[model samples]
Target chain A: MEIFGIPAQALYGQLALGLVNGAFYALLSLGLAIIFGLLNLINFAHGAQYMLGAYVAWMLLSYLGIGFWGALVVAPLVVAVLGMALERGLLRYLRDVDQIYGLLLTFGVALILEGLVAQSYGWSGMPYANPLPGSVDLGFMRMPMYRLVAIAISLVVCLAVWIAIERTKLGAYLRAASEDADMVQAFGVNIPRLIMLTYGFGVGLAGLAGVVAAPVYQVSPAMGSNLIIVVFAVVVIGGMGSIAGSVIAGFGLGLIEGLTKVFYPAASTTVIFFIMILILIFRPSGLFGSTR
Target chain B: MTADTAMLSVRDLHAWYGESHVLHGMTLHVGRGEVVTLLGRNGAGKSTTMRAIMGLMKKRSGSITYEERETITLPPHRIARMGIAYCPEHRGIFSRLDVQENLELPPVIGADPLTLDRVQAMFPRLVERRHSPGTKLSGGEQQMLAIARILRTGARFLLLDEPTEGLAPIIVKQLGEIIASLRTIGFTILLVEQNFRFASGFADRHYVVEHGRVVDEIAAGDLAAGSERIRAYLGV
Candidate 1:
């Protein structure tokens, strides 16, 4: 079996890996997009939050004897509370200030969080037990059941969030809040509470992605930084604050990277960045992004 | 009038935008169910006063009593939840929301919310464009929508900023009729407007704002007597 003059098994395996990577990318970037849209703050601390999710999940399993399934729910909740606290205590003060100040603040928070984790656990990563340990052979390729589950679940979650945001009244509020938050506040809806909850919800998506990643990758302090860099590239390609754009670009870019690995192995790592550059040069607002 | 009798009263309200101070000492009162107009030119701080009253202006010191309760310390949402709804000067219709969604966007704060049919009865164009994006409507329609949405919230006090600022003459006439109708139904409106002509048609009283302070107050009955002063202040 051959795909584009490449061995079918090898190509399918790469595509499966790409799908798994895309799942995480979509979730992470979607969170970033949501936070940026409403708050107008680029949350640089997102990677640290994602890492915290993995770390918290791992810690729960190790210390509290909580299993993967239990950690799945608990971990995101923990991250959300922490995110809410951060927004109330610090980010609230920077509302009227320049955007650079917000970036600096979140960036500083990221460094502090990442530093604390690195100190507690070595720069190297810890491992989590794969709850679904076996691979499922689907004729063409032997796919890890965990990866399959992760991909399937991420697709559903992303779809649900996109639909809710585009259709529901709460989602309408979220979108309008980003445009004219003061008006939303004037309507007697608490803007500060909404913003805090939104930040918590956005970062909690990262936490969700982290929980999904724990079995596939090592529980690492440095894990999120590497992945987030690629996710940022995905966001740039997708368009800022565009939910559907992020999900589609995440999967699309991941496949392109995987395809590059098969066709031209050398460019696999830089493929997404290259596409980001092209998108920036041509459609700067991104594929699905509105300029406003 | 005593503070107890007034629906809204602002005393010595001072607000600063960064270093440059905007509202110096904005003071005025609106009795319940009265359609009061704030007439001022650009940079006269009409919007700032509205923001200050709404508690949306962060850096401010003022005594704003609504329903005899001091609202100076309350935030925008809290003030809103208290049944004081603000419709911004830009006609804050959400581009992402359809006409119907925009109509339903404001959270209902009062016990008696207006039915969709009631709102549509006032602005029939809105019901026709209910499925279209709010921003897709004309400027007059957008203003009508902004004013329309707040009615659904069941807010007793409505702060409408320049509802006819850029609307056509017929639309402006229609908005005056709408304001007249709202007052007939017992809404206490504090309208911000530059068009003294449109406002004069329905407003029970007008407060002349200049350099962030209420320089003159005239009842609609005395509008004829105060016309010269108003024209000079308005620079019309």
Candidate 2:
């Protein structure tokens, strides 16, 4: 069978790859949305955190003789602790300042982190040994087992986070805190602790995404920087801090990008940005964002 | 009165909002089991006084003694934990949460908090709309939910900021009755009200605030004789 002058096999292969990419996008953008929602700050270091997760995983394997499974559990925890420290030591001080300063500060942090990693490991990509080193025939294409696992894991994580924020009592506090921190504090909730934990959780999600991506993409300093721009675009298209919106947009855009690759390989890279522009033109607040 | 006999006492309370001084040496006291109203016009520092007492004002310096403990330098949460509940002018209801969830939000600060059934009995309207979000409720319902939510915290002292604002006459009457009933059950209230007529009927005493300081205090029985002075002070 053939569609758009491309063989079905090629289309399916691209779709599978697109889904894998989408899973990462969902995870990263979900973190971005959470951080933005609670902290009201754009974490430019998200990409760096993602890179740190991958590098941490790689370091665990090479230096500590830990396997991929162990890195999967430990690397994110290490990065999350780093993220919490960064939040407490740095980001909390910038709370009352202008939003632009926060962006610049995080951008500077990203540059420093990336610089430090590049100096030690160099820019060349280092491959992590794939734990799931096989492929499965999924009727249309031979999907890599690791990619499939990544997709499943990412979906579960995204869904779990979404439920925690939207449906639970703790989530109600988070949503309320995002709106009015003073009011939440007045309710006798230790709001500063909540904000710190929320920032850590969001960054932890980014770290987890990095761990997942290390097997598929090379563990390199540029990996996070390379992927973060696309995730940002995904966030914007999905509506800045909308939880479900980010997840849906991430997966949908990934699929669209995949289909575009199969149809016109030249436009695949720029497709998400083009869609973002279009969405901005029509709905200035993004798709799911309230005009506040 | 000393802090020993008073439920809440603010002495020489001074507060600022980032270089702009709002409250300058303001002082007031609420006796145990008393229903007191801080009556003043807009921008007369009535709200600022409440904020200062609640520790919501960042640049506030005052000796706020509650239950004989000086709460001047305590954080808002700490002050809240010390059995003082503040319901701001905006109602401060979390719009994302349902009425039941909103009511359940505040932590219990005292040993004997108002049970859910007791609260529901006080405000039956809340029970009818327990599943509805805070923003979806009517103005009267939101006000009830706000007052009722704090009741669960077991707070003996309530700092209510203009609870009757923007409500219908009947709703205001109902709220006033609820406030009156609350006093009978032993909740010490410090109400900030603009409606002098409504407050005069309900409050045990009225403190006339002007430019961040209390210029006059009138007992409930003397309100009729002090009406002229209060009207001139309030400029209502």
- Candidate with top DockQ is 1
lDDT of 2: 0.90
Task: Show model 1 residue runs off by greater than 4 Å.
Answer: B1-4
Off by over 4 Å in 2: B1-4
Q: Taking the tens digit of each residue's C-alpha lDDT, what string does model 2 give over B151-200?
A: 98888989999999999999999988989988999999999999999998
lDDT of 2 at A186: 75
Evaluate candidate 1 by giving its C-alpha RMSD to the native, one decimal: 1.5
Q: Can you give the TM-score per candidate against the true fold?
A: 0.97, 0.97
Residue B41 in candidate 2, Cα distance off native in Å:
0.6
lDDT per residue for candidate 1 within A187-229, as digits (tens), equals 9887888899999999999998899899999988888888989
For each candidate, give the TM-score of chain B. Answer: 0.97, 0.97
Instruction: Give the least accurate 10-residue stretch of model 1 chain B, judged by summed lDDT.
Output: B1-10
